[model samples]
Target: MRLLFLTNRANALRARISNTFTLPERFKGTVVEKWAKYWTGLVRDYKDVGVDVVKFGYNKPRKALVITGASLGLYACVKRNPDEEVFLQLLRQWNNKLILVSPTEQNVIAKEYVRDLELVLNRNTLRTLSLGFCTLLWVDLYSKDDCTYKAICEYTGVDYLKFYQYIIDIGFWNRYWRLDWKMRNFDINYL
Candidate 1:
């Protein structure tokens, strides 16, 4: 079987392996070169195990696709809109296996991917709900700050009036947005 590995960042392979494995002192190079050598070694190992390895990025191959990265990379592949015909075509042709190797929990990744799928499947309704939630959060926290709201509106391309209407219609007063609860609790230095 053909094996293809996809990662959001090139260093993902190194990061994943470095946690449990030690590199030999003979493997001397810059960080990028070391990673490249490590990746090649991995491919060679797979080859010894009787798996046909396919190169990605340089030449596009029509075979089984292995995507190994952060959840965001998988999200991008699976979340393409119907209008993205070429992407859809490529997706359809491959037997795609996603390998998410990030610090984030698998369940969280799955949940977010599913949520994105839901948004794509029901674009109008889900998009409105998502935008409404974001808009409400921005309004609730930064209403007094003109620059923040202006930047938010500009970034999202959401009209202030429409967002207000959504909030009103959704009964913002009755519902808690939980913006603070969703904040990343862990320190970045730990990662």
Candidate 2:
């Protein structure tokens, strides 16, 4: 499988539980220490926990894909890169799996993904509601209410946030990967 790290900052790979995952602080050597440790630890973590995302295709090989973005780019990563045809073509060239790791939301958008999502909703809601609606749709469409999600609800009692967190941290995904630290420094640009 191939690993894809898509985010605005490459530094995210080193984030820990409480780190902000932004530029190095540059004070008292905080950024340097964090960066060095983050990279080293991540290499170890990926080796241990099986990485956050893995790509699986026709069972040939494995590869890695990493993308960085500030605001709007994050959105494109998830909603389907605007030049999806090109991306799809590129993805097909590799025998390895396609793993994509990105923040849950994006900053700027072309509105096409949103429009398509709106068509799926049964009611007349603003585009902003699409995120929640999509989450619901995923839960329903995946029948997660009865499977893993149900288990999450039964145990955590925190609803989707916890469920989503669980999935992100589950160490099963290979393509779409997100460093746990990105949750903190997430900008409101695309999301």
Candidate 3:
């Protein structure tokens, strides 16, 4: 499966994915070794699991997209930041499946960001642009110790019960390495 990883910063999520899976030898030297060197670039022939890494500010085309630190991107775009166009373009091109990964703190920030954007743009335009992907999945990477279904509902705008159904909690990273397993088992039928 071809995977495109979109992040707000360099090596943030790529480092995690690299740690979880064993990349091929070519990628070991070019991508795995020089990951820090690239803010946005393609890692071709990433073993049997094809993977590409790109930062949010970069203007690159991708099919199936996995957005890590999605809340940060949303915040930037909503605030009319430097990369707003890039973010809009990325969202416009997202026709295939999309997975958005964010921590609790960022998710809250994104909720506020979206609220502000709603005031600036037409509701339909914002909704169609942001929530128009074929298969959109929101994955919460971090939750508070006392986090509950209601908390997630307030934070994500998803219904309390539907929040559990849609969001993929790979568990805390400190608990164990679960991203690889979840990613491997991810249903890519939309792709």
Q: Highest lDDT among the candidates is held by which one?
A: 1
Give lDDT for model 1: 0.38
How many clashes in each candidate?
Answer: 0, 31, 0
Score each candidate by Cα lDDT: 0.38, 0.34, 0.37
Candidate 2, superposed: residue stretches over 4 Å from native: 1-34, 51-128, 132-191
Q: TM-score winner between 1 and 3, please give it.
A: 1
Model 3 Cα lDDT, one tens digit per residue, 96-178:
21233323323343333334433434322222112321212243323333265654565645455765554321222111122
Q: In candidate 1, which residue ranges exceed 4 Å CA deviation?
A: 1-83, 87-107, 124-157, 160-191
List, residue by residue over 1-191, the lDDT tens digit for candidate 2.
12434431333643553375445455446777777778868876775454333332223333332232334455544454223233223234321211122334322232333333334333322111123112111212222233556445555443555544323211111221222223223323454
TM-score each candidate: 0.16, 0.17, 0.15
Over 4 Å off in model 3, which ranges?
Answer: 1-156, 173-178, 183-191
- Judged by TM-score, which candidate is best? 2
Q: What order do candidates take by lDDT, descending?
A: 1, 3, 2
For candidate 3, what is the lDDT? Answer: 0.37
> How many Å off is the CA of 17 in candidate 2?
26
